[model samples]
Target chain A: DTAVSQTPKYLVTQMGNDKSIKCEQNLGHDTMYWYKQDSKKFLKIMFSYNNKELIINETVPNRFSPKSPDKAHLNLHINSLELGDSAVYFCASSHSTANTGELFFGEGSRLTVL
Target chain B: AQSVTQPDIHITVSEGASLELRCNYSYGATPYLFWYVQSPGQGLQLLLKYFSGDTLVQGIKGFEAEFKRSQSSFNLRKPSVHWSDAAEYFCAVGPFGSGSARQLTFGSGTQLTVLP
Candidate 1:
């Protein structure tokens, strides 16, 4: 069983189109995160949720919104995506909101906005 | 705020040769450090982490990292390299205790190309 799974492993859409990526973790973790990896392979944290509560928002654009319906799921929705939104998005989960735990990451969803 | 820096953008090593990837971090107090690896078209995998004592921490696939508080470095090392080890490595740092941001700041990854 995959610990962390992300839907739509690959997404290709127009610049103005909107898309959503869903993430679920079976690890029974209390914290989940969304990270963006740019073309240069620089990974940046976009959002984090702990037990369905928004814990951290890294000053991402308004177009990017994260919703966590429950503790085991966190979904990202991009509105009016731009060309620069072409990047890989990874969903990860940890035991808690503390910094000492390890993050189990999903395979990742590669998004390409044309 | 915490930040991580991976000085080497790319590294090449021959199979069976030893390898070392350097990682540096900046923070006010003791920081939680981690080393993650990412294969082609894959997500990041935790290699090793430095939380407290035992500066030299071992990880999966015969990998180890030493945390040096004096130099703010947590460098990963492997005795022998395999072609399968060719991938990107990332270093991340986070605040250790409470009353701080609970996010891991990752560095610009270093791509490893193992030669035959």
Candidate 2:
């Protein structure tokens, strides 16, 4: 079974359009995270939720919001997407809320804004 | 705050040759270090990690890393290189015991190119 999965493996949208990427993990983990990989292959943590509670929120812009309905699901929504928002978004999960554990990542969703 | 640095942006190795990727980190205390590999069009996969035990850690795909506290570095090495091993490697560091910081800081990443 796929440990972690994300919907819409590829997304191409116009500027100013709003889109959401849904993620689900069956690893039965308590912590889920959203990460952005820019064109330079720089991976940065966007947000993290532990048991549906907001745990980590980086300095991401307000237009980017993360919603965790449950421990197994965490979704990312971006409003009025800008060109800078074009990047690969990854969903990952770990056994605990601690960052010391290894994370299981999904295939990732590639977002392109034009 | 913790940060990771991968000095080599790209490295090319011939098939069957040994490989070593360097990674340095900056943290106040003992940190949790990890090496992750990302193939083309795929997510990151944990290759190995260093917590507290033996400085040398064995991971999948015949990859291993040694934690050198003196240098604040955890470098990944492999005995032999395969074309399939060509991918992007990332080094990450996380606070060891700080409960407040629950995120890992990843390095820019090193792209491995295995030549036939």
Candidate 3:
């Protein structure tokens, strides 16, 4: 079974359109995260939720919202997507809420906005 | 702010030769360090991590890293590399805390090319 999975492996949408990416983890982890990898291959953390509680919210714009309905799932919804939103979004999870844990990442969803 | 720095953007090596990927970091305290590898069209995989204990940490696929507090660096190394080992390597640093540390600051990845 896949430990961490994300839907919509590839997304191509027009500007101003709204989109959502769903993520699920079966590792029974408490912390789930959303990361964005730009064209330069720089992975930056956008948000993190621990046990369904919002914990880390980076400098991401308000247009990006992360919802953690439960400990096993964390989804990302982008409103008013623009050309700058084109990048690879990855969903990751760790076994514990502690920072010492290693993250298991999903295959990542490539989003291309025109 | 915590940050990870990977000096080389790309490196080419010969198969059966050794490999070392450099990674430096800037953090307040002893930070949680990690090395991850990503193949083409795949998610990142953890090669190794360092929390506290031994400075030299061993990881899967014959990979290892040594954390140096004096240098503020965690460098990944392998004795012999196969063609399959060619991938993008990333160095990341987490804060020193229970909850906040999960927010990782990753360096620009280094791409490895193995020549015949």
Candidate 4:
């Protein structure tokens, strides 16, 4: 289907361990982003890539790294996962030139750090 | 500071009743506003967005939102809500222009509970 798809919809791992979530979009958009929804359901942007170039990075820790292999894929790798790192991660994409500013999102990957 | 605020954490409405969810933002300049809905255990779906032009914007799934520059608010409304409308709603703000590289800042979210 033509949509933003992410792998490992649900992940449960022990603290201090590492894990990664991969996202792919077929929307042919130049901009992709990673957002984290906390337990309070507050969504916050972690990283943003436009045309495979990192353009925006919030105050996220260095342990969380985002790699965009191509314009269609953006992967997030978390090292030494902490219990507080557990949250639902979302992948979104949009046309940078679409002034209306609509974003298409993935189903989300729920991470539970035990 | 740039942030979005959703005053009501939870709102309950009877089926077939009208619904309104409040959203407020604090930004230095006029920002691009958007509303997104998330069903239970689902990803966010764009309801509508207002970048420029008309203050009132129509969205999918019978949703609509009005941008009030004076109040710094973008509130979502529905004439009649369906039972399936029970979900979490989020309000977000982006940079002022389409060429800006800033990411979105989302509100905490409001959970809508539709009673039968």
Candidate 5:
């Protein structure tokens, strides 16, 4: 069984379209996060949810919104997708009590905005 | 403002050769450091982490890293490299306190290639 999984491994859509990426973790973690990797492979945190509560909101655009239906699921929705939004999005989870930064990540979802 | 830097954008080494990847961080306190490996088209896997105690830490896949507080460096090392080890390696740093951001600041990854 996959510890962390994300749906829509690849997404290609026209500009101004709205799309959502779904994530789920079976690790029973309390903290979930979304990260974006740019063309240059520079990864940055976009959002973080702890037990369905928004904890870390990076300097991400307002068009992007993250929703956590429950502790095991966190979904990202992008409205009016722009060309700049075409990047690999990754979902990760970790236990807050773990002193390590060991995050379980899902195989990234590649988004291509036309 | 915490940040991580991987000076080398790419590294090439012959199979069976020794490898070392350098990582430096800037933080007010002793930040938690980590090394992650990402295969092509796959998510990142944690290689190792350094929090306290011994400066050197061993991890899966025969990877090891030494945390040097004075230099603010945590470098990854492998005695013998294999072709299968070719992948992208990233260095990340985060605050030490609980309930803190725990948001990691990742470095621009270093792509490693194993030469034949």
Candidate 6:
């Protein structure tokens, strides 16, 4: 069974279009995160939520919004997507108190804006 | 701000040769370090992590990382490289805290290529 899963493995849309990517984790972790990997393979954190509470919100554009309806799901919604947004988006989860600092990632969602 | 640096952007080695990937970080206090491997079309997999205690940490797939506090480095090593081990490796650093949220900062990955 997949511990973490993300929907729409590939997404292609025109500029200014809006899209949403859903993520879920069955590991029962309290914290979930969203990361963006650019073409240069530099991964950066975008947002983090703990038990449906927003914790870290990087300097990302306001167009990118993260919503956690419940503990098991955290979805990313992108509005007014630009060509610069063409990259891989990854969803990850981890236990809150575990000092291991190990993150379980989901299959990335590749978004290409034309 | 915490940051990670991977010196080698791409590395290629013979199938039976030894391999080492260098990772360095800058943090104010003791940092939580991790090594993750990413195969094509798949998510990142946790290979190993170092919180404290022994500097040397063993991970799956015959991978090990040594944390050298003096050098501010955590380097991953493999005794013998296999063709199947060709993948992108990422080094991450996170703050040591008990909060329910711990966000990781990842380095620009190093791509490994094993030549048979």
Candidate number with greatest DockQ: 6
Top-scoring candidate (lDDT): 5
The Cα error of candidate 5 at residue A27, in Å, is 0.4
Which portions of model 4 show Cα errors greater than 4 Å? none
lDDT of 4 by residue, B6-110 (tens): 999999999999999999999887788999999988899989888789999999999999999999999999999999999999999888557442457889999
lDDT tens digits, residues B2-103, model 5? 999999999999999999999999998879889999999999999998889999999999999999998999999999999999999999999765644356
Clashes of each: 0, 0, 0, 0, 0, 0
DockQ (CA atoms), all models = 0.52, 0.52, 0.61, 0.59, 0.61, 0.64
| TM-scores, each model vs. reference | 0.95, 0.95, 0.93, 0.94, 0.96, 0.96
Tell me the deviation in Å of residue B24 in model 4. 1.5
Q: Write the per-residue lDDT of candidate 5 for residues A64-110, one digit (tens) a residue.
A: 99999999999999999999999999999998777666788999999
Off by over 4 Å in 3: none
Q: Each model's RMSD to truth, in Å? A: 1.7, 1.7, 1.6, 1.5, 1.2, 1.2
How many backbone collisions does model 2 have? 0
Name model 2 segments beyond 4 Å from true: A97-100, B97-101
**What RMSD value applies to candidate 2?**
1.7
Look at candidate 3 and give me any clashing residue pairs.
none
Docking class of 3: medium
Better of 1 and 3 by TM-score: 1
Return the lDDT, model 3, position B98.
61
Ranking of predictions according to DockQ? 6, 3, 5, 4, 1, 2
Per-residue lDDT of A95 in model 1: 72
Instruction: For model 3, report DockQ.
Output: 0.61
